[model samples]
Target: MATARKYNVEAVFKGAPKKSDFKIVEETLPAIKDGEFLAEAIWLSVDPYMRLFVNSSNVGNTMFGEQVAKVIESKNENFKVGDYVAGMFGWRTKTISNGDQVRKLDRSVYTDDKLSTGLGILGMPGATAYIAFLSICAPKEGETLVVTGAAGVVGSAVGQIAKIKGCRVVGFAGSDEKVQYLKSLGFDEAINYKTMTSLKETLEKTCPKGIDMFFDNVGGEFYDTIIPQMNTSGRVAVVGCISQYNLENPEKGPRLNPSILAKELTIKGFVIYNHLPRWPEAFKAIGEWIEKGQLKYNETVTEGFDNMFDAFSGLFTGKNTGKAVVKA
Candidate 1:
C-alpha cells in the first residue's frame, strides 16, 4: 500500500486566514483499482480567491485549489506513467485522477514554458485576464484603460494585454516598485495607491481627458475612486477583489457605485471558467507574446511546500512583487 501526506483543514477562516487555520494529516492509499491513476503534485497554486473560497468549505476536508502534477503511475489508458497533468487536486502531495476524475490541462501551455507558469501567467490567472478584459471591456487602440492591483498576477497580465491592444494603460499598484514595474511594462502611468489617496487628482493628471475602460482587480475604494473618472459609456470588467478578501467583514462600500447608473457605465463580472473554450486562443497569444517580447511576467516564489500558506497570505499584504507562487 502507498501512503500520501495531505493537509486537511483543521480550522475555518475567521477573517483573513491565519497560519493556525490549517493542519497537516496523512493518509494511506488503497492500491489503484482498475480505471484509476495516481498523480503526484509537482506545483501547487495559491491565489487571493482562496481567502474567500475556503470560508464555506468545512474543516477536516482537503483544502481546495489546483496543481500541476506528474503522472507517476497509472492504469488509465488516456494517462500514462509519465504524463503531466493539471487538476483540482487540493493541497496534497498525491492524488487519484482517473480520466473522469481529472481536470483537463493541455501540456502545450506549460511544457516549453515554465511549469509554475501553468499556475500563474500561463494558467488560471492568464485566462482570467485575457478573456475578461478583451471580450468584456473591449479596449480599443489609443483608449486609456485603468487597472488596479497592477503588480499582482492577474492585474499585471491585464495591464500588459491592454498595452498589446494599443491602449494607454494606467496601472495602480501598492508600492513604488510595482508602479515602476508597470511603467516598464509600458503603462502610460503607474500610480502608487498607497502614497496618494487622491485618486481623482491622479486620474486628472494621468488621463488629462478620461479613462475609456477599467480592469478592476481590486474593488472596494480602488474602483470606487476610479468610477467617477470614467469616460461616458466606458466598460468595466469586475475581476477579483484582493483588497477586501482578507477582511473578516469587508467594510461597507462607499456609495459611489450609484454614480455608475447616472454615468451609464457598463460593468460586467466574470470568471475564467466560463471562457474555457478560449484556452487554446489565450495560450497561443500569451505564449507568442512572451517569445516575441511583447509581454513579460514576474513570480515571487517562496521555497518549500511547507511555506504554501505563508506565500498565499502574502498576496494580500503586497509582500509579493509579482505573481506569488510556492516552489516545491
Candidate 2:
C-alpha cells in the first residue's frame, strides 16, 4: 500500500482563487494492478488556465495540473521502474497510471538538474509558443511583432522566436523588472504597462511601423487598444485572456469589429490541446534553438507543495517573470 497527499477543490472559485478554496487530503493507495505504474511527483506546474478551469470543476475533485514524476514502482513493461515521465497527474504527491496520457521523459533533451524544464520552456509552454506563433502568425523578416504578457513562459518564447525570424519585437509587461527581462531576451522595446503614462502613446512611439503581428495573452483593454494599431493584414493569436480570468464580471470594452474588418486582421483563439499532433515539431525546433544558444528561459520555483496555492495566486500579481512551478 502507498499513501498519497493531494489537494482537492473545496469550493468553486469566485473572482480570484483563495487558499480556502482548496483542502489537502491524504489517502492510501492499493497495490498496483497489472499494466499499472506508480509515480512520485517531482515538479508540479501552476498555470493561469487552472484559475479559469477551477470554476467549472466539481468540489472535491483533485486540483487538475501537470507534473514531472519518477516511476517508483511498475507492473507496466513500457514504463520501467526509475523512468521519469511527464503527465497530467494533477496536484498530487503520487499517481498510479496505466500509461495513458503519460510520456516518458527524454533524458537526452534535459539532464536531471534541468528536469523542471519539462514543465516550462522545454515542455508545454515552450511548444505552445513555438507552434502557435510560427504557424498562426506566419511571421516574416523585418515584420514588427508585439507580445502582450511578454515576460511569461509562452510570451517570452514567442518574442524570442519572432526575433529569430527577424521580426522586431516590442513587449508589454507589468513591471519594470519584467521590462528589463524582456530586453535581456532581445526585445527591441519593453514597456511596463503599469508605469506607462499612456499605453497608446508609448505603443505608437515604440512600434512606429505599426504591429504586423500580435501575440495577445492579456485580453481586455490591451487587446482593444492593440487591434486598432495593427497594420493591414495583421495576424493576432489570442492565446489567453488572463486579464479577464479573475474578474467577477467581464470587463466591458469598445468593440473592434471595424478595425478588424478594415485592417483585414486574422484573429484566432487556440487551445494548446488542439495542436497535439504538432507538439513534436515544436519541441524539436525549440530544443535545437536551446542547443544553439538562440533561446533562453527562466522559472520562478516555489519550494514546497504546500505553497502551490501561493505560487498560483502569484500569477495575478506579476510575481513570476517566467514559468511558475512547485517543487515537491
Candidate 3:
C-alpha cells in the first residue's frame, strides 16, 4: 500500500486562522482501480477565497486548495502517465482522481516555465481577470480603470489587461512594495491604502477624470469609496473581497445606493467557477499575452508543503505581491 500525507483541518477558523487549526495526517492508499489515476502534487495554491470557503462543517477534512500535479500512474485511458493535471485536490501530497473536475494542463501553454503557473496566471486567477474585466467592465481605450488589491493575482492581471486595452489604470495595494510592482506593470498610478490617510482623496488625485471602470477585489471601505467617483454609466466587476474574508462578522457596508443611481453604474458580482466553460479562451489569450510580453506577473512562493497554512494566511496579510503558492 502507498501512503499519502495530507493536511487536515483540526479546528474551525475563528477570526484569523491559526497554526493550531490544521494538522498533517497520513493515509494508506489502495491501488488505483479502472478509470482512475494517481497523481503527485507539485504545487498548491493559496488564495483569499479559501478563508471564506472553509467553515465549521468541514472540520477534520483535508484543507481545501487547488494543485498542479503529475500523473505518475494511471488506469484511465484519457489520463496517461507523465501528464500534468490541475484539480481541486486539496492539500495532499498525492491524489487518487477519477478525473471528475480535473483539467489536464496543456504543456504548450506553460512551456518550460514553472508548472506552478497553472495555479496562478494561467489558471483560475487568469480566467478571473480576463473574463471579469473584458466581459463585465468592457473596458474601452482611453478610459480610466481602477483595481483594488492591485498587486494580487487577479488584480495585477486586471491592471495589465486594462493597459493593453489602452486604459489609464490606477491600482490600490496594501504596501509600498506592491504599489511599486503595480507601477512596473504599467499602472498609471499605484496607491498604498495602508499608509494613505484618505483613500478617497488619493483616488481623487489619481483619477482626476473620474473612474470609468472599477475592478474590485477588496470590498469594505475601499469599494465604498470608489463608488461615488465613478463616471456616469461606469462599470464595476465585483470580484473577491479579501478585506472582509477573515472577519468573524462582516462589517456593515456604507449606503451607496444613491451613488449607483446618480452615476447609473452597472455592477455585477461574479465567481470564476461560473465561467469555467470559457477557460480555454482565457488560456489562449493570456498565453499569447505572456508570449508577446503584454502581461507580467509575480508570485510569492513558500517552498514546502509543511508551510501551506503560512502561505494561505499571507493572502490576508498582504505578504504576497501576486500569486501565493506552496512548492510541494
**Candidate 3: TM-score?**
0.98
* lDDT (tens digit, per residue) of candidate 3 on 97-176: 99999999888766556688899999999899999999999999999999999999899999999999999999999888
Clashing pairs in 1: none
RMSD of 2: 0.8
Question: For model 2, how does the per-residue alpha-carbon lDDT over 12-127 read when each residue is reduced to its tens digit?
Answer: 99988999999999989999999999999999999999988875546888999999999999999999998999999999999999999897898888689889999989889998
Whole-model lDDT per candidate = 0.83, 0.93, 0.91
Off by over 4 Å in 3: none
Q: Which structure among the candidates has the greatest lDDT?
A: 2
Poorest stretch of ten by lDDT in candidate 2: 51-60
Q: What is the lDDT of residue 276 in candidate 2?
A: 83
The regions of model 2 sitting more than 4 angstroms off are none
For model 1, give the 10-residue run with minimal summed lDDT: 100-109
Q: Evaluate residue 97 in candidate 1 and report its C-alpha lDDT on the 0 to 100 scale.
A: 72
Runs of candidate 1 with Cα error greater than 4 angstroms are: 101-109
Query: What TM-scores do the predictions have?
Result: 0.95, 0.99, 0.98
